[model samples]
Target: MTAFPLLDPALCFVILTTAVLAVAIRTVFAAVVSFIVFGLLMAIAWVRLGAVDVALTEAAIGAGLTGVLLLSTVARIAKHRADRGDDVPILEGPEPDPAPTDPLPGLATQSLAIVLSAAVAAALVAAVALLPVPAPGLVAEVGSRLSETGVESPVTAVLLAYRGYDTLLEIVVLLFALLGVWSLTADARWGGQPGLRHLARPDGVMAYLGRLLPPIGLLVGVYLFWIGGYRPGGAFQAGTVLAAVWLLAVMAGLVPIPKVSGIRLRLALVIGPAVFLAIGLAGYPLHGAFLGYPPAIAKVLIILIEAGLTISIATILGLLVAGAPEERPS
Candidate 1:
């Protein structure tokens, strides 16, 4: 019989605290910060569940990239309000009445939600608890075919070969999102620098750190991509790190954000998808199915595809963080 796992009391406490603060913090900025912490805690939980690939994704995209994106948006909001001569309010709902000062609005509604949440939690626990002693699994099959896929990592084999179609769609979706962000630029600000520009101040810690970090980050990012076929890293994780480095440079005002309309910038955003499509199309003549790699050069082709994807993913994510242009080009 399967045994129920004991909860880690410390992890549970941190998660609850961060989650409550994320919803309850009066200021939007504080709430967003709390939410970022919550994402990181969730990443830890994913790791504890023995899903290392999911954990990397949760850390790179969920916690790291998403946190930076939200923080940037928050800065934009604060700037927008401040520029309009508006006094920024804490902006919160009314405190719940301790005593029954009149009928408590939504009390029954809140109670129902709690009950529903508890029911869902109990159901999940029961399901896990009742899992078969020899749980059904597919690790053996994945391992057996891993060598044929020309990758040492079973996870990479699944992503690049078995589920290649799904990966292609995900890449295209990223491109579509990039197009949307670019479309939001004002006509005047079209092709202008993205996000806010920082003044050239070498004395600031941000600028100092920005200058210091990119080289190291770049090295690590490349290593992650290179080792992904045999290890825990991959295009998304590596690309996110590269994107973070680029964002840091832009945020520090050390480097200007590229214009949306720049040819090179546009190419950076689309090249991966374009290359992927080209290879997939070639499969019709060279192989029986789409995205099939010639067995002899499968590893080579996979590496090439991942390289282009890393660049494009980095570009798309960086632009997402920068957001649409609000000001016209100088």
Candidate 2:
């Protein structure tokens, strides 16, 4: 029995150790940085395991996008601390510290959480190490039939054509998450000057970089979207990259967020999932199953779906970063 070199057990052991150390450390910044490294290593493991598509997604979304999000949150929190003159208020109003009580209950809860996580991890390891290989038997059959489908990649074909419903549902899940986030901060107005006032300055290196980056990002995003049918790129991947550039522009005050979301913004945010669902429901009558594409127009439909999804995803991400119901230029 042989293990994939990138997926070597020893490498995984090292990753787990590093993650544990990061989590146990008291420094929030260190923990956030470690998570980013963990995401990159996970991508490497995926590539080694012969899942290039997943690896690309992990690298783009897990490492790149997530790291930015975490850093932004950290920056905001740090600024808040500075404004408050302290990170935590030590029971203000001259209240005396309560008599120290037994720490047993907190200790018990922490111990329980640790034990349960350890048990689950051990079980997962045992299952992976002991289970017989199941995918090898099916992958050969799938690969052989790949040519029969118009899509070049088996993963693409399966995701876009054979199991489109799953993709459709996943988009719905994304929408719901956005809605949930919106709900969480419903009353909080997102538009105002960010703590980084220098970001609004126009004459510095930041302005120069902001002026230069968006067009390049747009081209790269379009290229990724077009090439995804046969390559590692896709709508979701492209959208995230594009969103980051958009976010940069917003942060640098080059592109001001609108106070009220315009018709175009609203449309872009909903069009992808709406079109996908409409097509899926329509396919039941026309194609005999939900999300089943017609023979002559399947490729066209997939492209259309991907395009809508890309716009929607990018808009949602931008809005998330804006953290406002309607962002107005500062």
Candidate 3:
């Protein structure tokens, strides 16, 4: 009744070659594009391995969000360079001869890297293709134990129950990364260009698309979060989508940058990690373990943690995109 899918060795070769070439390229823009391609190929690889959740995550976060972040950083760096007069325009007079480039570090460095990468990849491939499957794989065991953990999917069970501490730490890592970026931004002035000017309401196709798209995006994002426990959808993906919606709203001039970052904003930003850590600590007293939600209420706790994480992540992303503090409108 069903047809089986065959693996294409040629496709695998092409993808791997492309990934290597992308890394080898010197240009930042080309490298970014190549990385996005690499992520896409990796998503395909995940699908081939029958990992739908990983594939979705790779597509959404790896390829989509990371690409946007890279482009944003590039634009910011370009602007900074222009402001500092680091880049000079070429004159239209006679074509000037190009300057000779200096040699990179050393041959040993490149050779060492190449050898190491080749050896590692070969070893991994050999292990996968040549080694026999273990009698009782850990994956099967975990899947079987999912019911005891109050999670339907093995992935969810592992993330929310068996290894929840790691997930909690990951959320903290996101928060820390956000804080680090904010700190590195320093006290520089944005010069009144809040980056929201381009999002102005205008009469044309742009306005029509803007009006039509955000509602649909919001709906999709909410749906993803609601179904995350049962499906591939999860807090990280939903938060990113919600952040996109918030950014779109700001760009459309529907929501201006709020200058009054009083108590509320701070609380929203911190509450997610705070509540998560508190629950983890509370678990130690109740269950003699950290971040171990009781089976009776584990599902609800997971949902609640995800909700907080989504809100915090979205808010941080929006603020980072806006280049807050310096550009906040009074």
What lDDT does each candidate get? Answer: 0.83, 0.74, 0.72
RMSD of each: 4.4, 5.0, 4.5
Among the numbered candidates, top TM-score falls to 1
Candidate 2 residue lDDT tens string, 1-330: 355555488779867976886687556677778888888888888887878889888998888877877877877777666697864522222223458977666878999999999999999999889887663455677777665546666777777777787888887787776666566443444433222233567887777788899899999988888787787778888888788888778777787665433677768789999988887787888789888777767777778888888888887777666554532234
Cα displacement (angstroms), candidate 1, residue 281, comes to: 1.7
lDDT of 1 by residue, 1-330 (tens): 225345566778999999999898767778878898888888888877777878888888988888877877776766676688766532343323346576655988889999999999999999999999899888899998787878897888888778888889999999898779878877877888776566757789999999999999999999999998998888999999999999889888888788777899988888888888888888777787799888877888788888989999999998888788866777
- Return the lDDT, model 3, position 169: 84
Please report the candidate that would top lDDT against the real structure. Answer: 1
TM-score of predicted structure 2: 0.81
Displacement of the residue 33 alpha carbon in candidate 1, Å = 2.0
* Residue pairs with backbone atoms closer than 3 Å in model 2 (clashes): 258-327
- Global CA lDDT of candidate 1, please? 0.83
- Report residue 246 deviation for candidate 2 (angstroms): 1.2
Q: Rank candidates, TM-score, best first.
A: 1, 2, 3
State which candidate, 2 or 3, has the greater TM-score.
2
- Where model 2 places Cα greater than 4 Å from the true spot, the runs are 1-14, 87-102, 105-122, 134-137, 147-149, 186-200, 326-330
Please, what are the lDDT tens digits per residue for candidate 3 over residues 1-330? 214333557558868887887778656567677888888888888887778888877887788778778767766666675688864322212223359777786989999999999999999999788867664457877877777766566776777677888888887887777666556443553222235345465765656666778899889888877787887777777877887887777677666655424567667777778878888888887678888777788888778877887788777666666653556333
Model 3 weakest lDDT span, ten residues long: 88-97
Model 3 accuracy (lDDT, Cα): 0.72
TM-score of each: 0.84, 0.81, 0.80
